[model samples]
Target: MSEDTTQDSAGFATRARIDTSRPHSARFWNYFIGGKDNYEVDRELGDRIKEIFPGLVDVAVTSRHFLGRAVRHLAGEQGIRQFLDIGTGLPTADNTHEVAQRVAPDARIVYVDNDPIVLTHANALLTSTPEGRTAYLDADLHDPEAVLRAAAGTLDLSRPVGLMILNTLGHVADHQQAQGLVRTLMAGLAPGSHLVICDGTATSEGMIAASEAYNASGAVPYYVRSVEEITGLFDGLELVEPGVVRVPEWRPEEADDAGSGAPVDAYCGVGRKA
Candidate 1:
């Protein structure tokens, strides 16, 4: 085909893959977290969900804050220098690489996601410190071996890596399946590697209602689980102090606002591989 034809075909394929007709989880979460990379559909769903559970906004905001604190702890206190962040959503402020490289300039991070939109915005996530490296893999989380193989090109799997799943695993509807996926990913890493996870929990009626509404909107379903299920993701690993708890309560910083300490629907924890 001609160059112009090839370009047009590629553009068409990209547009086809991004279904703006319905809200997507990444874009909807981006809208919830005050980002500009979402469409009207995402905003509409986000606004509707807010009406169902105003606290859902807190879950989004506080979960983001939890990411910063978690990366800082891993890169600073734990002496980790590499990261494999799967299901990393749209690039926003204080992303995994930004937070990790800030604590340890030489930290290497590989971000994994299969969303075409996320891939388009991957350049924003590719910047790294001179001492560190950053790469984006167009890979899915269900296939642990493929993700690890691609990440190995950027990260050293033989060394301890900070595996971050964040709000992404909720896409897997089955609790056992999600737990098994986490175990498989962890099994591929070294002994000292740490698993950092946080997700929305079905701790309240409003949150549950919000989850049902969002899932009904034709977006990929995100199943919020009980705190017990959330903790179960770290079964083989040693739980960091404070164990699994509300995102903000895990390790609050002095700079956080008073509301940051309040309970939200999201829960998070860091666990070290033995």
Candidate 2:
């Protein structure tokens, strides 16, 4: 819980200022995922949300599983080498680069986040395969062009890249702008680029209650959409098999570990630009 706000030389991180007065999205996510990079405030809010919706911890874990599955599909099966992961929360097990690089050592990844705490953890994220590369951007997702421009230093935009915005779009309350931002980013990538997304939905009373409580918390509000609305985010892209299903339903690992067969409120999909 040290409020360390160091920046890298790329200026991807601005002033060293870690404001712990209120819970932030990245910190809360870290707390939910059981990472040690969060403060008491984050853990308090996370616990409160769990009280409102006990299944939130499950949603967080399964969403991470979806990330590993999606990245595996893109890197191992689809042969995608470059990945643009926006809204990458605190680094944890099976991160985008870790998952992708494990499959294909030459895979390049660029992680973007506007949070400075994430900036402080950039060193942990910047570790990449000598055959590949990884970079972190302290940039905003609302501006796709700038992200791409900054990413161009590491990724070849002319080639197919996997664009991942998992559990991030909900932070953008404006529906039209969210979809538009996605399209803008996709439009910039080459054909066959993949887009991976997963976010919580108002699918259950518990989830709805959880969303309400989280919104009331002083932290940034995350809007959960309906199934149809969530699925529509990939309107023009060609969805992969078993399209827009629950996170666990998407090519889950063949393990006997079944936390609960009951569906979590989170929805996700992986689509190809072509």
Candidate 3:
């Protein structure tokens, strides 16, 4: 719930083709993160899940912090100047471009998302520094080839890119299929490209219950994997230090790591292709 939603939403309702009749994962997540882009149904389910398991709010909040740290590391330390951020949800403070450009002003970024609500808010995510470039693609992650083909217009595929797919793989029900999707995308990028992944894990009973409750709320089901499964997603890539641990523990800043040591039901890792 720590993400700052500073984007203006004037005339968003007229432009967006959203189905408010059902609960959506993106909107639900938006509600959890304290964004105003969600509908009443999303807030209702979010509130229900909050009562079922309040820790989920922390997962939403901390997962975003993990993103900022990861982007900073990639742009500053890894010297990665291009980023391909798939499954980009609603825009918030310190987005991929914002974080990357802060470290490297000329970092080029391409954000891909199929959600209509996200497309409606895409303008907010498109703002970039004069030295850098940012573009949005209304593409599905299921079609990695198409996603890459479209992204190539904005990003140079020959150079190393920071491929980010955070909190999004759970939508793919089958584990192998999800792995293949990642492989297909990574295969298209040049060597030295980093694979950044973070997703909910079946780490505790409460988290599992929360997942079930959310699925039963008529929202798109988001499956949580075990820590071993999460690690498997980064199979061929070289993992960074403290590999595949909880989100907040991955290269955390002093103040962010202070009291956030409690176990969160989400795990993340950054890996590089040789």
- TM-score of each candidate? 0.95, 0.93, 0.93
In candidate 1, stretches whose alpha carbon ends up further than 4 angstroms from where it belongs are: 1-12, 258-262
Alpha-carbon local distance difference test for all models: 0.92, 0.89, 0.91
Question: Cα lDDT for residue 159, model 3?
Answer: 95
- Better model by lDDT, 1 or 2? 1
Q: Could you give the candidate ranking by lDDT, starting with the highest?
A: 1, 3, 2
Q: Report the number of clashing residue pairs per model.
A: 0, 0, 0
Per TM-score, the best of the predicted structures is 1
Over 1-274, each residue of candidate 2 has an lDDT whose tens digit, in order, gives: 3334332343442434677888888989888877898889989999999888888888888898889889999998999999999998889988999999999999999999988788778889988999989999989998999999999999999999999999999999988899999999999999989999999998999999999888898888999999998888999999998999878888889752324667788999998998
Candidate that beats the other on lDDT, 2 or 3, i.e. the better one: 3
Clashes of 1: 0
Q: How close is candidate 2 to the true structure, as a TM-score?
A: 0.93
> 1-274 in candidate 1: lDDT tens per residue?
9999997787677667888999999999999889999999999999999899988889998888889999999999999999999998999999999999988999999999998888778889999999999999999999998999999999999999999999998999999999889999999999999999999999999999999999999999999999999999999899999999998888898775425344699899999999
Local error of candidate 1 at 128, Å? 0.9
